[model samples]
Structures are given as structure tokens and as C-alpha cells.
Target chain A: MKLEKGVLLTCDPAVKQILLMLNNRQPFILQDLDEFHVVIKAELEAWVRSQLETELEKNTYNLE
Target chain B: MAMQKGASSSTSVKTAQHSLLPFLQTQSQQSLTRLYQRPSSCLSIFRLLDPLSRQLILNLLWLESPVPLSVMTAWVTTEGTRAFDDAVSILTKLHILPNPSVKLSLSPTFKASMRQAIIGGGTTASFGVPADAENKKPPSPANLDAYALERWETILHYMVSSGRGQRPREPSRGVIKLLTDSGLMSGSEAAPQITSAGFQFLLQTPHEQLWQLLLRYLVMAEERGIDLIEVLSFLFMLSTMEFGWDYSTSSLSPTQEVLMEDLRDYGLVWQRKAKSKRFSPTRLATTLTSSLPSLPTSSSSSTNTAAVASGTGATSEGFIILETNYRVYAYTNNPLQTAVLHLFVNMKSRFPNLVIGMITRDSVRRALANGITADQIISYLAAYAHPQMRKFNPLIPVTVQDQIRLWELERERVKSDSGYLYQDFQSLGDYTTLVDYARQMGILLWESPAKRCFFIREDGHNVMKQFIERRKVSGGG
Candidate 1:
């Protein structure tokens, strides 16, 4: 599904997981990406990488 | 899942809160980052936001550079500072605004997606397509509206009537399961009993009722291994679909086809035959994005149905007139309306086209016990306030509203919170700074100056921990 522009469309399972959570009524924080086993398209891969990186930073900050 | 169900006594009161905007706000950052990938979802969310939030989003949308919090606050009127801050905080919570204090700008994905929806030139077909050009007959708006109202109320009637020892047309098995799964009802499908959530569901506005059910449907669909993105896009696409027009189901994906069938049962769509290739979107489907919760002509469908079934011309504007003496004069004979009113009203008399009831302290408290809040009852009344009563400065008397709230508040004499209690401090200076930080973040639930102790919400721990970390790093630097 074309959830965002500038990202190549792929039938990635991770996208499906994201879609499920997006529709979820209750709040959830993204904790693990390993749970979503899907290939990320090259262009979108960079965005995913950055997202994980930012989350990592935030988690580390809290730990500190 | 238990949290949403609010099975716990302490959380039962707070957990019942559900709305599209708050739902979006609680989404995971990853999910939101992906959700904003679609222009339609962006626009849908933007439409759902409050007016102040909309203004804030638009202001940030067109910015060439990130604006500081001070600059943004300066743009708002002095009286609107709180609203401005609330809007920014909501945006921030949704990750739509990365940072409010440092800078304000729409998230990259939302910015692009919203821009696309407004300009409207995308092959994504996100707005929906008129798939059937060869339809022999298109459904009329009035027919579609009536069908929608009838089917929707069938579900409502099923819930209310079953509880009140009356037999109404049985709702579909899927609809029954939805109510049961959402914790709105319990018991076997044929004899489902209304739960506290069911009472709250009955009191919600039509639009909210629709969204809550639809959201539950999404979860159910996901469990069935249906693609949620396809279902969600189709749902959003329905919101944009033209009312009373036939759309071909031929082009729909397998998942969408499944959704279309479910929509038909809910009366959001009409199919002449079970295998019909074309479906006409009903008013319920078309008005999904509408901000107005009440339909002008059809909001009183309960009364209309009652009039038709009884062969009487009970003309009324779907208004509930409340007097200062706690007497309620409702201008309809709809059993469903009467059943819902019976939840919180002590009926004294009933007429062919009218029901008179008194809103007593016991009744209000009973409704509260049923998990229906006073605000919900007041809003329900305000939403259906008689046109003649609308001329009044306040639709319901202020004294009556206050009394209802006061009665409900009596139960809140003992409050409960699940949070972390902080007491030990190395020094008074350390306690002072941490307390100040917690208060500023609006996470401080309680504090005592003498003990140098404070209580904060559980979620506040991460921020507090990070704040201490930041102080250490800065001081060391």
C-alpha cells in the first residue's frame, strides 16, 4: 500500500505490521523491528534505517 | 488488549475513552511514519483533528523552515494560548510535529502526503473510482439513506431490545461477534447481553459509533489474515465515495471484496444480489469523513421508523427537550430511543408520539455505574436538542447539567491512579529540580513539598529518566 510518497511500493510484510498497528485503537510504542520480517525497498530502506536509528537513540537516552 | 477492554476496575473509567484523533495520537512512531505515506490517510486524519489542531497543522504545513515554539505561540490570540499549546502537544504526541519547543514543522511524510491530497493528481486511485459505468439503475439518495439507517439501527435495536426483554430483528452473526469482541456485549451470540461498553456505545454520536465499530472490524479482519492496509485504504476510500452512486466491485482486491460484503451488512453499501458486481455507497459510508455528527433529516430515523411501523404521522425534529425540573420531553416513539433513554431516565408517561421522563440523581448515577459519563449524557442531549430549544442560550439548563455532573462526581470521591512514587532524594536541590521538570512536562500527578516526594504517570518515567540523562551529559560537557 502506498502509505507515503518518495518510497517505492513493495509487498513487504513489515509494511503489513505497520498497517495493523496504524489501525489499532490503543496506543503502542515501536519496540522491535525484528518482529516484522519483510524486505524494505532500497529507497524506503533508508527511511526505515533512520527510523530505527532514531528510536535506538531515544531508548539509549532513556537508559542513560 | 485488556487495557482497551478496561476489565480492571481502576482503569475502567479512563479506558473507555475512544475517538479517531486520540486513536491516531497513540499510534507507534513507525506506524505513523508509514501511515503518513498515504495522502488520503493524511487528509482523513487532518479532517478528524480539532479546529485548533487543524489550524496548527496548516500553519506548519506551508512553512519553508521550522518555526520556533515562541513564534508559533505569538501567532495565536492571547486568549487561545492554551488551545495553541494543546494543539502543538497533540501534534507532537502524534509525531506530526517532531519538536515543539525547538522547532515546529510537519513530519516529512505527512507534509508530502497532505500536499498530494489537496492538489489531487495521483494515480493511486485513493479517492475511489466509479467502477461501474454500465449500471442499469443507480440507487437514489433517499433509498440509500433509509437503507443505511435501517440496517444501522437493526444492530442498535438488537442490542437495546435484547437487554430490555423485547425481541427485535436479529443482527447478523458478524455484527453480533463484533459487539461481543469489542466488549460491548457478552454472552452467546443469540442471547448477547449488553455490557457497560454497550451502554457507552449507545450514548455515542452516530459518527463515533460507526468509527468505533469499524476500528474493531479492522482488528477482526487482521486476525483473519486479511491485509489491513487494503482494508484501511478501502475504508478511507469509502469515506470519499460518492453517495447514491454504483461502484463496480470487479476492480476491488480480494480483501476489498471481503470488506464490501461486510459493509453491505452494516448498510454502508447496497448490493441488489449477493453476487452483484456493483455496490452503491449509502449515506453512512459517504459521510464517514463529515465533521458533523448528526444528520439533518435522517438523525431522527428511530422516530421515523417508529412512525412508519405504527402507521402514524409523528412529525418531530429529533429533539430532546429538557426542563430545569429534570423532566425530559422527547418527541418520538422510537423503542430504541426510549430504551436508551430508559438507561438514564425515569419514565413517568408515554404517548403515541412522545415520552416524558425525569432525570433524577439516582438515574444519572446509575448511568455512571453503567460506564456512561455525565459529559456523554450532556453531549447526547445537546446533539439532539430540539430546534425550539436550540434558541435557548444553553440547550440544556446549566443547573441541570451541573447537577448531573455533581452526582457523577460523587462516585469520584475516591480517585485511583497507577503510577510511580518518587520519594528518596539526595538533596533538596535535586528534589526541587526533578519536581519542576515533572510539573513542566505535565506528568506530575501529585507532589509533597515537605517530604520532597512526587508521583508521576508510568509513561512519565522515560521522559524523566531522559531528562536526568540530559542534565548529566550537559553538566559533564
Candidate 2:
């Protein structure tokens, strides 16, 4: 067994897929756990979150 | 602290207000024992205890010896065991009661001092000695009330006006220092800016706000090389003092004399002049430990019509009306209230008794940027919701509440938890066993059976490692 310290991010599988795509551009995930979870670099968790938010914001409908 | 949990559980609507109980719980046992050395501190701490704890203490106060655990347990009904346990736990934490096994009793110092406080024959004069009746022109209670309201309002108005980017009359240097040191305000001493915590402080009842400031003042006092016991005993003594009664300053210890200066800044006590030999405990000081409203309620004191006309009368009552369309109508001419509302509402118009505003996306975003949470805004609105609006179950309109929350949620898209990720298990059985063990230990954060991986909290890594090593050895055997 192997153990490593990092931030655990759990989300929808679709969100995980997007995160994987983003990881290709700039590595933030330390290890991919499964379809819905990944171990992210603790320091980059904020950056990864903001990246995901920006990505999700594009597809969302804005009334204003 | 346990008492607060018990109180919150029973009355879910009443948010836990700031009190000296939580502050005292954080003190060292030696400090707490020293605090209980005074009769006034004993009485004051007793008053602050939850009802169940007070009952238990009273039952054991005069006992010559410890009571049997079973006998004390029998006094509480089965339905009250939870509250009883909570009360006992708080008492033990405060060191008011000795640890329980087969018997329970109040601590020796606390019991003796508490007895003296009740029986009243101590030469120590833990209660203040009244000044001689030589000063024939002592301020009446009504004048003291107005003085306290003005002094307190000045501090509050300073905080509110700072948020509006305007400069009002600044409070004393000590008050400003306490405000900044407490994280209620940020920025320089010359131009302190109000923080989100300051905004929440504005919404709290005057009693809670005073306690919050005093707790911070205690911390400030400790850093200044002043005796904590002296400050705490003075505060408790002030609580027990009668409003309008002048206490001689000559009897105060040197540390308490310094504390008197700071307390005067907060309007807790009124002194005719800095060199006065005696000072009167204002309404704020007397109401410190009691359940009485710190500020004069509109219904209680009609004699303070000047206070009412000055807009201080709205301190305790609800005066806000929030509608479904997000329009906010506040029937308060109080500038302090208006400035607090201005924090999160886009003001449109103001009349004699009403202010109109709107809770818009930009307005809420502004508040959010200032570090104010959605729940704080919603609760502040709900707390001061107009009587008509309070008829609803949730107080504030559900739509407005949900919208404010959604705006806050937009900023918090991801939650992060640091832990150890366990992967590359040798077998499904090993993975399942380890996962079950982690779950049993209540340290499991996330897991995936298919991937043969799981996450355990950072603090549990050592325990999990020991478990794995033991399992390996046993399986090898």
C-alpha cells in the first residue's frame, strides 16, 4: 500500500473529466482516485477550484 | 460552553450571544480558582451558569461534605439527564465543581466565597463600599441612563460611520484600540475601517456587544501586565452594583483603578471628573450579568423621552421590513441602524421614520467581498425583521434568503480537506478491511472501492500505518 498527503476533491464525474482535461494543461492533481474523486496538490487547490469555476461559468445561463 | 449548547438546543431561534462563560472556560484552572477567590466573582459566575447548573450548585452549596453521585443523579428526572450532564460538564470545566466519581461537590474556594456572597458578612468588601454621602448633587438614575446611551452610541456610531467612508466623532483611544485588537475593525488608528465581524457586532444586542468588547478588553488587559483576577473581579462587582450608586475609587486596587478608566470609556461607569473619588455604575454595568436588557427598552422607561426622541429607543425592537421583490423598508431613523443596513443594501430614499433600499446582486457581492457571509446577512435581517414580516415561519422571505445564499455559494465552489490518500492495495480484501477500519475510526474522508483507494484524515495517518503493519504481520503468520 502507498499513502500520500494531499487534498481530496470529490465532485461529479463530468466535473472530474474537466479537471482531468485541465490537468493536461497544468498539473494540479497528484493522483486520480476514480471517476468522482482525485488527490489534488494541496497548494494548488484554490487555483484548481477557480479554474473549474471559470469552466463551469461558461456553460451556465446568465440572466443579467 | 456546554450550557450554551444546551440552551441553543432548546431554543433554536435564539442564537448563542457572546458571554463571559466561553471566555472563562478558556482560562487555566489556576486562573479560574483565583477568579473565584472573590465573593463578587463567585456570585457573578453563579449568575452566568445555566439554570440546571445553578440548581445543582445551590443544592451542594451548603453541604458539609460531598454528596453521593447516585443521590445527585436521582434528583434529575430521566428526561433531564442530557441537560444535567451538560451542566455538570460545564461546572467541571469551569472548576466550579470537583471531578465526579462516586461523589460530587463544589470546589472549596468557590463554595466558601459563594457562601460569603450569599450570607453577606465578609470584611473583604468584594461588593463595592458606597462612597460617603458628602456629594449632595449625585446624578439621578435617569441622567445616568442618558449618559450611558450617549457614550455607547458614540462608539457604535463611530463604527457605522467608518464603514460608510465618513469620519464621525472618534471614540477614546482605548476604545479604538480594543476595537482593532478584537478584529472588529482593521486599518490604522487614525482611520480604522470596519470589518465584517464589526458589522455582525453592530447587529448584536447591546448586552452581547458589551460582553464581546469586555472579553477583548480582558485579553488586552492581560497583555498589559495587569492582573486578570483584579479585572474580572471588578467586572463582576460592577454587575452586582446598583445603578446610580456611587462607589469609592479609593477602595479599588491599583489595577482596578486603571480598569475603571477603560470601563469609563465604554460608558459602563460614569465619573463626574477624572479626579473624582467616586464613580457611579451606569445602567450598562448593572445589567452586565442580569437578563435585563442593557439598553432601556421603549416600553420600560417612558421617563427617558429624550432618549426616545434621540432614536436610541429602537435599540432592542425589530424595525425592518423585507419584501419578496427584494425591496427593503426599514422604519428606523436611527443613523446607526441606517448605516448598518447600508452595508448590504443599496439605499434609495430616506424619510422621517423610514429608509428604502434594495438587496441587489451587486449590493450582496459588495458585502461578500467585505467577508460578510450570507448567513450573517440573513440572520441580521431576520433578527430585526418587522413585526408584520416576523409572522412568517422563516422571518425573511425565503426567495430573498435563498438568493443571498446562492450569491455566496457562487464564491465557494470547492471545499478542500487535507488527508492521506491510500492506493495500490495488494488485494480487494486488504482494501476492504482497511477501508472498514478507517470508517470505524471515523477518519475516512473519501473512498473508491473500484479504484482500491481511500482517503484518511491527516491526523489518522499514523494510526492507519500501525494498523497496516499489524495486519501484515498477522497475515504473514
lDDT of each: 0.71, 0.84
Model 1: chain B TM-score relative to the native chain B: 0.70
For candidate 1, lDDT tens digit of each residue in B313-420? 333454589998889998876677888888899888999878999998767877897889887788778767787788886567888888888877655432334355
Off by over 4 Å in 1: A1-64, B1-18, B25-34, B52-112, B294-317, B324-326, B359-369, B373-378, B391-394, B397-477
Colliding residue pairs in candidate 2:
none
lDDT score, candidate 2, position B31? 89
Best by lDDT: 2
Q: lDDT tens string, model 2, B66-105?
A: 9998999988899999988888888988999878767899
Work out candidate 1's RMSD over C-alphas.
Answer: 18.9
Best by TM-score: 2
Off by over 4 Å in 2: A1-6, A12-35, A52-64, B1-18, B22-38, B60-70, B92-124, B132-136, B157-165, B186-199, B297-316, B391-394, B406-410, B420-441, B455-477
Most DockQ-accurate candidate: 2
What is candidate 2's CA lDDT for residue B299? 28
